[model samples]
Target: MYSICRRIIFLETVAGVPGMVAAMTRHLHSLRRMRRDYGWIHTLLEEAENERMHLLTALHLKRPGPFFRACVILGQGIFVNFFILSYLISPRFCHRFVGYLEEEAVITYTKCLNQIDRGYLPMWAKMDAPDIARTYWQLKPDAKMRDVILAIRADEAHHRLVNHTLASINPEQKNPYKPGE
Candidate 1:
């Protein structure tokens, strides 16, 4: 349980990076070309915000100490730079990478949910869903931790599909989610 929670915390910290990097690079690209980004800017920025909420939710569950916080800072610094460079070089590859990360997040959250269901984590036995999660997802007041996990998993799945679809589309094509002509 400790290990699982630790992994979730660390992963969530890194999880928010790609979307932010993508949004930043895309925004700069759009500015340089003096054209709209279609809808990628908003979508990517929203993705970053959602991932930050996930990190916030997880932090409510587990508060790591200074050492772990330092690790998270270092890791995120490295990852942000790497992802920024990667996106600049090949946006499609960056999208594919984020898609894969979201896929892994879904799997990890599922395993966490399974552990909670199996009575392995006593702390999670009757955990209330965080208010931030409920508000972000607009869940009922009665929603529990498991419900929040499910919601997060669904978000990851959606992100995975969106990123993968983006990766496969031609760069010259307009954004897939753009307003209709």
Candidate 2:
């Protein structure tokens, strides 16, 4: 369970980075082109924020050790650059990658929930959801850690679907810098 928790925390930290890089890159592209992003900036940034909240909630569950935190920093740094380059090269491919990432997140969280339910992972008797999580997610007063996990999984599923759909549509066709063209 400890390892699983660490994995989720690490995953969440890395997960948050791609959306931010894509959002920032898109914002720069939009600004350079003197055109609106048509709402993708907001959606991607919101996804980043949601992923960040998941990281924070996991932190509340267990403060990661120094080694773990270092790995997270390194992982995020590397992943951010890779994702930004990928997005610049091909937004459709980048979105597809994010969709895959979100699908994995949903699966991971579901596994965690199952572990908790099966008593393989011992949770607090009355663990309350993190205040940040509750506020960010607008969760009810009775929300617990399990509830938070479920909500995060649901959000990831939604992101997965959205990114998959966006990848299929390829809305950034209007951008002049179509790589490989």
Candidate 3:
């Protein structure tokens, strides 16, 4: 009976160590990668470090009863799954709006480019047009929308550059800048 109790104790202690070590190693590796990848973003790095510290503190707390521990683990699993689901759902909605904004930008920029090419106005005159380029920096989105909008804005800027170059080449041409004209 004593031998059986000893074996059970040993197995219980030994079993958790490997799992804890594996989890700690994985978490540390992820933190290191995040730091490396986002070195320029100090705020993000700081937040990640803070979260890591919190997780470590939680891990080192005194052990709970078996039922309580099981409940805690189950709760964590549900929370994590819900968090991931919400994260995914939020981006889907954000991207849909971003697509709308991008499409609007393309149309507005195209119209401005068309007007400039047709000699209806000079390049400087159209600079303040209400296209993506003019208003992109003014708009703010939830975190997910910001990146998507910025990318779309960049593309619009590139298109503007190309169209401006084409327009400059033949200032006297009559509507030579029309799309596929």
User: Pick by TM-score: which candidate is best?
Assistant: 1
**Model 1 segments more than 4 A misplaced:** 178-181
lDDT of every predicted structure (CA atoms): 0.85, 0.81, 0.36
Which digits, one per residue and each the tens of the lDDT, describe model 3 over residues 1-181? 2232232223223222222332343345447666331121232232233223322322322244687556656655664455344424452332233334334545644554454466654432323322332333343333222232243345544333333433244322332323311
Error of 2 at 1 (Å): 2.3
- Listed in order, each prediction's TM-score against the native is 0.93, 0.89, 0.24
List CA RMSD, all candidates.
2.3, 5.3, 25.3
> Which window of ten consecutive residues has the lowest lDDT sum in model 1?
172-181
Give the winner by TM-score: 1 or 2.
1
> In each prediction, how many residue pairs overlap at the backbone (N, C-alpha, C within less than 3 A)?
0, 0, 0
CA error at residue 125 for candidate 2, angstroms = 6.5
Per-residue lDDT of model 1, residues 143-174, tens digit only: 88888889889989988987898899876566
Q: Give the clashing residue pairs of candidate 2, or none.
A: none
Residues 1-181, candidate 2: write the lDDT tens digits.
Answer: 6787788888888888877988899899989999887767777787788888888888887888889878878887888888888889998898898999899888898888887788776663257888988887789988888888888899899889877876887565433222211
